[model samples]
Target: MDRSNAFVLVGAVGAGKSSLFNVLFDKEEAALKTQAVVFETGGMDTPGEFFSHPRLYNALIQTVSDVGTIVYVHDGTDRTCRLPPGMLRVYGGKRVVGAITKIDMPECDPDFAERLLRENGVNDAIFRVSSRVRETVGPLKRFLFGELSDGPHACGDVERKKA
Candidate 1:
């Protein structure tokens, strides 16, 4: 698996995208509010405005154009699905997946978030994770980097497994 191409994380505001980005890259520093597209090793962290505002969709599109994978992060506690219709379909050339973030929160309903992602066009693997929990991040990392023994790498059209 080529780990050189970055994976972009997109989601609504306060969805824990940046936190997951830090975890994925093993960054010990605190994740601050993402005001714009921030490029880092292995992944790209995007601001929530790009995903939530239609006018900024172009920015989101441009940000992900070069990435090999697009991980759509969703807040588990947020019941609403903010994905515009066919928005993710635009990235036909990239691998699209879903991550229900902040699942460790007491009010988080990962099941609902998963259902919302499915209904919103995320047909790939959907992982339930908490950025602060090391255990939860491992599966996602393996899935993203293709470290799983069952498949070559996730960038390939591998079998979709729910995490």
Candidate 2:
């Protein structure tokens, strides 16, 4: 389990999964391919189709073999979460982080995304960051690297699950 890139991310298409991944790690730029799985020294990025199709979920479940954390992304501009309830818990025992991408969009409401994620059993912290802006992603980076002190974030910092 390499901590450097031990995070694996999942989200529907257009949720900015690749943008966030690129910003988080200074990796070589590449054109985004449809339904392609991107693996790095530290993390893995899956295609949106994986989640939409139940059959592909096995691949995501199997991916847990290498990652220490799982992050589910939400597009703040989207009208709905799209994920089935309790989807975050599917990767049990792995730390899960929820992120709302495109938060800076004019009509984007990160709060709504956070609520949707929470209702879906994302007991840990839910973050709001605009992948388009590098600065907005720093908080998420800190949380991902376990750099923040543990506490309930009124503004969404890292938190422990309630039993």
Candidate 3:
């Protein structure tokens, strides 16, 4: 596996990173607790612990070291951001995008999630999607698969659909 050409998912616990991973990879099984890093076809799924715990920062850094891109998953219904300050700076050379998940949930606030993601350091394309909704995930999948063209929108300004 030439991980340098792949992408990796990172976020706090319950941010739906695993669910997005399963959806992106076309896995039919339920998402399980990601106790450790799991490598799949196009990307890698990282354990949230590696991101939320300061002590595990090294692990997270190492886990994504080889990947060319980083997808930071944020729960749309949550108001908090667990991404440590200057954490993403470590990967200055990697393409860091954002994904606001759970937009299908009634309580989700994608606008706030997008604001939080921007405040944290996701200056690239930010995708808002629901794992259960294939249509919503299309743009992201297309972008990741090198099929999405940079249409009228700039990188960080992609609007998410409201449920």
Candidate 4:
């Protein structure tokens, strides 16, 4: 797999999209209140505002087509889902992955977030992770590195079995 093209991340505000980028790529870019699209070495972090407004969806779609993969992040701590059902199908041209962030938060329920992601069309692989701890995201890291298979194992429930 080509590692040059970046992975684009899109999600609701405060969903830890930027933080995930930092954790995935080992960067210190703070997930401050982002108001516009921010590009990094391995990922594209879009503002939650883009998800809040419908007009920006076109821009998101365009960016998704240009990337190697699309990562849709959900806030595990927030039960309320901001994305429409099966939204991943919209970016069918690119690989789509789901990530449940804030897994370590007080109110987080990773199982619920995982279900929400599956129901919303994260067809390739779904990852449950806490961006606060890089090691907790091993499955996702492996997948990004093309070392982990994009099968049921990508759910990040069990440890990846050796080939």
Candidate 5:
């Protein structure tokens, strides 16, 4: 897998997206370095920051298309399962993998995660994770770097696996 491949982290506020970002970049403590530069093996630009604005979804889709994979972070504690329309439009029907964040929290619900994804039209590999404990991130990383490593593929394989 190319190291320079771009991976977008999508999640609600305080969902530990930044924490996963720090881990993937091998900068567990590097979040403190505001001016730090990230390097990728594929010679692609460093990963971009997460954006909630609908206007930026188009740009993000273009960026993801140019990259290798995307890591979508979902807050397990959030019951509404509400996804940003821009995100749904950008990632819908794509091979993006879902990662449930904040598993360390007492309120986190794994079952609800499946329901949330189903309702949000996310029919792909969903892994429960905790950025704080560093658990489940490895599987997520492997999945992102494995089957999802390719750009623009059918989400059917992932959906069938879940089914």
Candidate 6:
């Protein structure tokens, strides 16, 4: 696996990050299952157990700095889908591909999620997704790896990928 070209998942708890991770990487149990929290999907050969915590920003930073792209997951169902303050502080101007997970849920609001990103200064690309369904994960992956493929410093590389 190339650590230089990996994808990092970030979001609040119960945001379906793990579920999206599993769907994207084609893993059934990429993250530990719980009543509330869900992990993000990935191509990691060794899938680990999921643990909830408030320090996800640190994890996002470590993962983003090491990997090529960051998949910042958010719970679209939640009215407050804004990026965490710590995350914004660390990955503020970076190339983060936003993903609104749990689109199948009743409360997932695409407009609110987009508004949250704008309010938080996240001007980069964003994607709405439902990890429970396979098809929704494809666009997010393509956006992160296809259009946002260039290095963070490269210009004209932040355009959203076309489906």
TM-score, model 5 to reference: 0.67
Model 1 segments more than 4 A misplaced: 1-4, 149-163
What order do you get sorting by lDDT, best first? Answer: 3, 1, 4, 2, 6, 5
Best by TM-score: 3
User: Candidate 2 at residue 143, lDDT?
Assistant: 75
Q: Superposing all C-alpha atoms, what RMSD in Å does each candidate have to the true structure?
A: 6.2, 6.7, 3.3, 5.7, 7.8, 7.7
Off by over 4 Å in 3: 152-163
Residues 1-163, candidate 2, lDDT per residue (tens digit)? 4653488788887788888888888654743854678877667788888777888777766765567788888887787776745566655567877888877677776777788787776667777776556667777777776677786432332222233
Q: Which stretches in model 5 have alpha-carbon errors above 4 Å?
A: 1-5, 30-51, 86-93, 147-163
Which pairs clash in model 6? 17-39, 17-40, 18-39, 18-40, 19-39, 20-41, 21-40, 21-41, 22-41
TM-score of 3: 0.89
Enumerate residue pairs that collide in model 4. none
Candidate 2: worst 10 consecutive residues by lDDT? 154-163
What lDDT does each candidate get?
Answer: 0.79, 0.71, 0.83, 0.74, 0.56, 0.57
- Could you give candidate 1's per-residue lDDT for residues 76-125 as a string of tens digits? 88999877678788867777889888776777777788888989888778
Q: State, as a TM-score between 0 and 1, how close model 6 is to the true structure.
A: 0.67
Scored against the true structure, residue 76 in model 6 reaches a CA lDDT of 73
Residue 118, candidate 2: C-alpha displacement in angstroms = 0.6
Q: Provide the TM-score for each candidate, comma-separated.
A: 0.85, 0.81, 0.89, 0.82, 0.67, 0.67
Per-residue CA lDDT of candidate 6, range 41-156, in tens? 33221111122344444444554555556566667767775464655456444556677766666656676876886676556777777766667667666665564354332111
**Could you arrange the candidates by TM-score from highest to lowest?**
3, 1, 4, 2, 6, 5
Candidate 5, 157: how far from true, in Å?
24
What local lDDT score does residue 148 receive in model 4, on the 0 to 100 scale?
Answer: 80
